[model samples]
Target: MDSDSRLDLEFAYTTYRDCCRDLYSPYYYCRRPLGHDGVHAAGFGSGRVRWEHRPDHAPHLLS
Candidate 1:
């Protein structure tokens, strides 16, 4: 294939890889552990998942 054809093939391959990733393992595939706020601003350093409860809600979590 020519340069343009090769580029098109590479793009197609990347798209297919992303599609498979999203379909099979949308979460926990390449995801790092989230903190209490569920944002990536800062990661928990203790190697443990933590959750913070709202003033009106109870705390819950899974290992």
Candidate 2:
């Protein structure tokens, strides 16, 4: 896979990951427990695995 001209999605990807990471954190839940899920946009069917939405054991997990 290759991008056509200097396309780097690292920023957007990392930002989203960071946001989700925070939201799923225990501290964030303490601040705001209520959260919601979004429908997959590309017709992700029932075959997709449902991930657990609990906080990581530590920040920057698997880094």
Best by lDDT: 1
The predictions' CA RMSDs to the true structure, in order, are 16.2, 11.9
Off by over 4 Å in 2: 1-34, 37-43, 56-63
lDDT of 1: 0.28
lDDT of 2 by residue, 1-63 (tens): 432111123223333334333223323221111232431111023422223444443433212
Model 2 per-residue lDDT at 39: 17
TM-score of each: 0.23, 0.19
Model 2 misses residue 42 by how many Å?
Answer: 9.7
Q: What lDDT does each candidate get?
A: 0.28, 0.26
Model 1 Cα lDDT, one tens digit per residue, 1-63:
863454334334443223212111222121222221232111123432222334564322222
